[model samples]
Target chain A: MISVRGVHKSFGGVHAVRGVTFEVGKGQVVGLLGANGAGKTTTIRMITGFLPPDTGSVAVAGHDTLRHSLAARAAVGYLPESAPAYSEMSVDGFLSFRGTLYGMRRRDRRNATERVLGLCDLHEVRRRRVGHLSKGFRQRVGLAAAMLHDPPVLILDEPSNGLDPKQIGQARRLIRELARDRTVLVSSHILPEVEQTCDRVIIMARGQIRVDADPKELLGSLREASPYIVEARGDAAESVLRAVPGVERVEVTSRPALDFDGTAWHTFRITAAAGAIDLREPIAATCAARGILIRELRREAPGLERVFLSLIEADEEGLPSPPGRGRWPADGRDGGGSPGGAAPQSHGAAA
Target chain B: MIPAASAIAVREYRSLFRVPVGWIVIALYLFLTGVVFVSSALIPGEPASLRYVFGISGWLLLPVMPAVSMRLFAEEFRSGTAEPLMTSPVSDASIVAGKYLGACLFLLTMLAPTLIYAVILAAVSDPAPDPGPILAGYLSLVLLGMLYLAVGTLVSSLTANQTLAFLGTFLFLLIALLLTGDMAARLPGNIGAILIRLGLSTRMEDFARGVIDTAHVVFFLSVSAWFLLLAFVAVESRRWR
Candidate 1:
């Protein structure tokens, strides 16, 4: 339902989006995943007809955004960044005004207003002024306003931006439900939110599309040196973990500040050799045969963050990243190094 | 187009009441106009005409209308609501028209309460006030208000800073009024004659004396349209950059 061909946009000297190209088919839930300033919002704005590309064209539902902007805009609903809505107006009043702008009849405006109010779970605050609501509620109010017209295409920029955790869950459910019959394109800097909600993820970095694939395909491409995160109650666990056949390196990540049970538990991050087979079983069998207690032994699952990070790292440091994996770090640097050992927490992420 | 413009107009008009700035502007304008009515026209043997109030009210609009219009686009852009609005399926003209008309309607409301001056004079004066000049005086103020607001709307569209929009509009109107009202009297015949015809304060005289001049009316409306057109172009320019 949306096609962008060689789109380039610049603001004075800063090139916001450069030579970006992608197409989103009908009924697909796609996420433009990126860090801040990755040109996701710029791309969405061009598609919504709020902006015109400097060198290329964006078409929505077969309507060129530059040549037939009104029709292109008419087919899509957009929620801009920060979820801006007129704070002076009530939710019901704002949604009705939105309907009127779309040329809906009085009865149709009322019905649509009611429908979106319910869809976004905003009926309780429908009569209150938008400025009087909390940030999460106001964000939902913006979402409600965008989908008010029931357009076939929905383009939301950071839709979960200001919502609380519960509200984010509700919004994810709503976006999934809405994408059942429409082409939905959402952008976010949150990695798991994209992984959890999007059917296909297009990871962008520095105004370029670095990676685009399904979540599973991204995970399946992790053939680099996979790490085994081990937590046990012993000092010898490190050497025991390193003694496994597939083990190449083992580093102690953390030790407890105080031990209530006489001995401190140490956390070990074990990097497996390339093309290792079922290291979890081998590590567990080795630890069990040696009489070293194994409190936890699990292989790290590759996440979109890993793929996303490596790609962005390649962009920054001229290194080869793996969606097709062969090489590890060229200098034997730490795989998950983020300066203070706060990195590798995503190993705790539920993939 | 009509529906979209009217919808935006109605929203703008009502929005002026929702914030403290809108109420403060209306209050200040009516208070100033009331003081003028009481001090000059309400006196016992003052010809029972609305000349004094209407004359100063035109000047009052120089400051007053900009306050009403400065937020028309600037506030939207500041709060980021312009994204949803400009991206909607409405044309640029309707958005500009709606905002301008909304401010005009506000000026009309602020002036409406002053109509009691006519009834007051009619009750007390031996000969009631001349209805023609009274009606003409109002027409003059309305046109002047519309013209000033168009200028304010154009200034508001150029930037997202309300204070800058307000100051830019006030200074521009002040310069225009000064050139046509003061400088026109000092210059030589040809330029002076042209300035006199173009001067809003001078043209208001024809209205106060109960003469409806078409050239003066057209000048006010056309210049207003020209400014609004500039505003529409300014609004459309946002898409390119």
Candidate 2:
């Protein structure tokens, strides 16, 4: 439903987005992730036809954003980052105004306004001025305005910004409901929100797409490559762990962290073999059975944060963007960090 | 195009009444025109006509119309509401036309009460005021309003600051309508002849005398159109920047 090709945007001398290319298919809810000044909002703005890309093009619902901006804009329902609205207008008044911009008839406009008001849970505050509402309510009103026309494509930048925890959960559910038949592209700084709500996450760094893959793919890849940290005092720990079923290899990472009561306390990193069960339970049981002093055994949970940081760090070091499955440990070894040398280096054609 | 422009126009017009600034500008304008009405139009032994009222109102609009138009685009930019507006399917021309029409509606509202002064003039005078000059005077007022509001609209589109828009417009009007009239008399030749004709105040004099000169009417409309066209270009240029 949306295609951005070779899009480059510059503000004065700063290149906000450079040679960025991505596509969001119909019915796909894609989350855009990035840190401050990472070009997420800039990219969203270009796609919404609010600003023309300095080079290249953005097309929405088969209409070019620059060439047929009106048609392109008509296909898109955009919620800008801060969700701005006229403070003087009532909630219903604002949505009705949006209806006019979309060219809906009077009756249709009233119905759409009523529908969005109910959907956003804005019935009680419908008659209140928008400026008089709380920040979270204002944000919902902005979302309602975007949905008022019932456009096929939605490009919301930071939709969950000011909501409370419960409201954020409600917004997540609302977004999922809205994306049932529509294309959605959301950009936000909140990682877990994106991880839970988006099917696919695209991570951008320094004006480029560094990682683009399914959320599960990224997490699974990182989990397969990550190693667990074990801090304990045990006899023959390395050979003992390697002999355990489902254990791939074990290595002593550092000298004794402490010498407490005449015994050295050391740290080891344990790696599990490919398709092996989680090693935490098995490792602990084995240590207990053998009378080894077990202090800590914890696997690095490979969530979206690990993958996001890895791609960004790799980007800083001048590595190309991924077919990020390349970051997985194809050799079945643990790399154990977001920017492990092997993960980004192996990145090429592997998906 | 018509629907979108008209919708925006309605919003803009009604919004003027929604906030205190809108009512404040309207009241201030009526107050200034009322003062002009009492001091100039109601004097005994003077000709019972709106000629003086129309004349001073031209100068009155020098600052008043800018106040009406200063917020037209500047406030949208200031509050960041321009995002939803500019991103909508509406064209830049429609946006400009809508705002222009809205401000014109406001100008009409401000002028509506002044008509009562005319009724009083006709009733109180032994020789009723000639309706010809009264109608023509109003025609001049309307023409001058079109040009003045158009200037305000054009200036407002260029900046995000309301004060700058108002000051810029006030300065431009001062030079084009007032100073040019005085300058045209001293400077001789084709340049002087052109300045006199182009002087907005000079043209108002013909209309106040109950002469609806087609040249003056065309001049007011064409200049206003020219200003509005520039405003359209200014608005469209934002995306590129």
Candidate 3:
């Protein structure tokens, strides 16, 4: 329902979003993951026709954002960052005003306002001034305003920013419910929230897309080359562990002089390659051939947090990112060694 | 577009009355106009007339009209609500027109209570007052308010700071009033005549004399429309930046 192509936007000398391109299809809840000032909000603004792209184009439901902004905007329900609303207005009043702006009929506006109020669980506070409502209620009111017109595309920036755990959970459920039929592009710095709510994730840093993939596949790929913790007691245990076939790097994490059975126990953390098979059997065979007595051995599943941090760290260091499984470059350009070597496609379908 | 603009205007109008500032503006305006009327227009021996009342209203409305229009767009920009309003399906022209109309309506409310002065004049006069000059005087008041409100609205769109908007609008109106009244007479021949013709005081004097010239009406409307259009352009420029 949204197509953004080769978009480049700069504010003064700051290149906020640079040559970014991505598409969100019908009924897909795509998470835009980035740190602060990573161009997520700028991209969302360009797509929603709030800010025009400097050198690219954005289309919503086939209407060009710049050329047919009114039609494009009519199809979008945008919840800007911090969920700003007319704080002086009541929740119901805000929804009704939004509905009217979307050109809803009187009866339809009332009905839609009622529906969103119920959906966002804002019925009890519908009559309260929005400024007087709690932060969670204010967020729900923003969500309700966005849903009031029932637009096909919803662009939400940091929908769960200040919510407590329970409110965040409620927000996640509300997004999931809304995503049943609508196209959603939500930007957030919170990794787990995005993981729980989005089907596919697009990670951006330095105003560029670093990785884009299905969350499960992205996490699974990290799991394949996961780290291992090994502790052994023997002569040259570190050397033996380093010589193992699948072990790419081994570091002596702890080498305390503990006299266990007249031998010093040592611990090492091992990192395996992407194609590493089960290192357990190979390590075991190698350790037994030597007189190394195994103390502790376990593999650590790479969490999303690790993957996110690694990607950001690589981006900060100017290293070629480990291409996310089924990833695509944000821009069609092949610079920065993005490993999804295939030619960039115009739109991404539901994975 | 008209419906959308009207919807915005209605919302703005409702919000104005919902807050005490709106009531305060109306009360302050009526109280000032009352003081002016009693001090200047209530001549014991003369015929009941509102000539002095309408004459001073143009200057009186200068400061009051800015207060009414200062928050039209500045508050929206400050509170970050302008994002949603702009992202909505309404056109820039519609938003400007809506806000201008809303402020004009509030100014109208401020002027509505001043009608009591006319009633008192009509009731107490030995000769029932000629409704022609009175009607013309009220028309002049409304037009002057419209023009000042439009100028204030334009200033409001220029910045997110309401104080700046108020001061900017106040200075502009004050200069306009000064140029047309006192300064115009000090200038040389053609310049003096031109300045006098452009000043609101000249047109208001004609209205007080019961001369309803279409030229003056057109001038007020065109100037108001000019400022409203400028406000629209100022607002739409945000998208480019």
Per residue, candidate 3 scores C-alpha lDDT tens digits across A134-180 of: 88888888888888889999999889876889889988998888889
- The C-alpha TM-scores of every prediction are 0.90, 0.88, 0.91
Q: Which runs of model 1 end up more than 4 angstroms from their true locations?
A: A223-225, A231-243, A255-266, A286-293, A318-351, B187-194
Measured against the true two-chain complex, the DockQ scores of the candidates, in the order shown, are 0.84, 0.76, 0.72
True contacts kept of 1: 0.90
Interface RMSD of candidate 3, in Å, is 1.0
Return the DockQ of model 2. Answer: 0.76
Residue-pair clashes per candidate = 0, 1, 0
Better of 2 and 3 by TM-score: 3
Cα error of candidate 1 at position A14, Å: 0.5
User: By DockQ thresholds, what CAPRI class is model 2?
Assistant: medium
Off by over 4 Å in 3: A230-240, A252-268, A280-297, A322-351
Candidates 2 and 3 compared: the better one by DockQ is 2
Q: Compared with the true structure, what per-residue lDDT tens digits does model 2 show for residues A49-70?
A: 9899998889999999999999
lDDT of each: 0.84, 0.83, 0.83
Q: Give residue A192's error in model 3 in angstroms.
A: 0.8
